[model samples]
Target: MESIKLHQFVPISGEQKPARVPRRKVNGPATAALLIKMATEILTASPTLRHQTNITLTDLAAAEKVRKALLKTPLQ
Candidate 1:
């Protein structure tokens, strides 16, 4: 599988307020890729955006369970 290049928006103080930063490169199967995407979506959908520092342990545990299950299932 080809590596996926992920980027995040970094706040700047210039004409371009937000700059794209290369976060990481993900090289994995389809299932792993889907899980990563889902986890990112879940974190970004948090209610408290501005003041949120880290995700709750419960949320991380739940995500880990889902990821394990996904790893077992075959990619469609």
Candidate 2:
């Protein structure tokens, strides 16, 4: 009769896995201000402009403008 042996495997050192953190949305006034800024730029630029941005610093204003640009439609 012959005896059988089981083999054990071990993970290599320094092979630490990355930790994932859940993303939390900021709803404070700061975020509101930032979103407002982003929205403002998107609306101010010409619809047919060849350049990049839909909005620009030239369009600085209140949150009303960004919300207006978004319109009644929800983001995709």
Evaluate all candidate structures by whole-model CA lDDT and list the values in order: 0.65, 0.56
Determine which window of 10 residues in candidate 2 has minimal summed lDDT.
50-59
In Å, residue 9's CA in model 1 sits off its true spot by 41
Prediction 1 TM-score vs. true: 0.33
Model 2's alpha-carbon lDDT is 0.56
Structure candidate 1, residue pairs in collision: none
Residue-level lDDT of model 2, residues 6-76, one tens digit each, is 88887757877668898986445555556765655566654544135444444455456555554544433
- The TM-score, computed over Cα atoms with residue i paired to residue i, of candidate 2 is 0.31
Clashes of each: 0, 3
